[model samples]
Target: MKKFLQKYSEFMRGRYGVDDLFYFLMISTLILGLFPNFLLKNGLGLIRWLLFGFGIFRYLSKNFTARSKENAWFMKVFRPVKKEIKFLYTRIRNIKTYRYRRCPKCHQQLRLPVRKGKHTVVCPSCRHEFEVNIRF
Candidate 1:
């Protein structure tokens, strides 16, 4: 059993690296169609499906004998949800776009949008008041 497990892990390691694994998992999650039961319960299944579809595209582009331009063209033509999926994927992939801001009055950590500007922000956790100066 131990040998079998080790061999399976090795095989997977060779066939699919970290990125491929992530793509596979995301696709499987959508295929199972159980996001509503656990991960997303607010009718975000379409978004999830669109993201998984994008993952399928990315995975195929990497492993299959297809040109990058072709893959990009496919994605451009499909354009799942046009705005929602793209927005969600962008937010998920962009770590730099998400920042942790602390409220001055309560010191509670708040998620602030990234950009260059000052805006009045409210903390839901502690009901704190603060101003966020986002610089790009």
Candidate 2:
């Protein structure tokens, strides 16, 4: 096993192995292939296989620069989506205890403690102040 791993690592020296795009492709493939629609299933099945095959090809290919560029581009598109999902998840987790607000100037999300009556809210990111009544 040690010998095999060493050999495999050596074989993959100049190749681009795993990256964020690879994981995203894999997860998207699994999700798209999970639905029950026959047409969608077949189409997504092909897409999934293509993505998997492409990832494997990338892993074995020695074109490291192009593969790295592709991964960077994918991350440029994927980070915001990931952040939004995380924000939603945290908001849901703290739904009853806190309220989520966005700063009008900077569009930054703020988590305020839930309370009754009127209060002034400050946007930490932009240093903008605003007032809101938390009647919950």
Candidate 3:
């Protein structure tokens, strides 16, 4: 029994660690405890308060201790790097290539080639065909 308990603890530590699993369990218990009965009766407005409390607890747990400080540092570094990479990708490539023209019949946005002069554009939404005055 003790051997099995030790092995389970080791596995949990390897998989998610003590803090993460504790937070997950706490949130899960709160959700499961309130979801079936209280959620239907009170709706999302009341559940949002519970969610806010969970958020506050999670924020405190991830900012108030040494281990949490390491997690916070990792999150801070990771998010900015990811965002900068995304920004660089967007800046390097032209997203204006996917610019659309509004249909004359239904006024729905239609994807057309980015070129100068008039062109026959078709709107898939309204199945309307019209000539677009494109100036590039």
Tens-place lDDT digits, model 1, residues 25-122: 48676565754765465666666667676665555443543444554665565556556677667667865868666687777657676777888887
Most accurate candidate by lDDT: 2
lDDT of 2 at 68: 91
Error of 3 at 24 (Å): 22
List residue ranges in candidate 1 displaced over 4 A.
1-94
Query: RMSD, model 1, all Cα superposed?
Result: 13.0
The Cα RMSD in angstroms, rounded to one decimal, for candidate 2 relative to the true structure is: 3.1
Tell me the deviation in Å of residue 25 in model 3.
25
The Cα RMSD in angstroms, rounded to one decimal, for candidate 3 relative to the true structure is: 15.1
Model 2 lowest lDDT segment of ten = 36-45
| Candidate 2 lDDT tens digits, 46-91 | 6767877887787677888998999899899889999999988998
What overall lDDT, based on C-alpha atoms, would model 3 receive against the true structure?
Answer: 0.61
Q: Write the per-residue lDDT of candidate 3 for residues 29-60, one digit (tens) a residue.
A: 57766666666676655555565565445544
Ordered from best to worst lDDT, the candidate numbers read 2, 1, 3
lDDT of 2: 0.82
30: Cα error in model 2, Å: 2.3
Q: So what's the TM-score on candidate 1?
A: 0.29
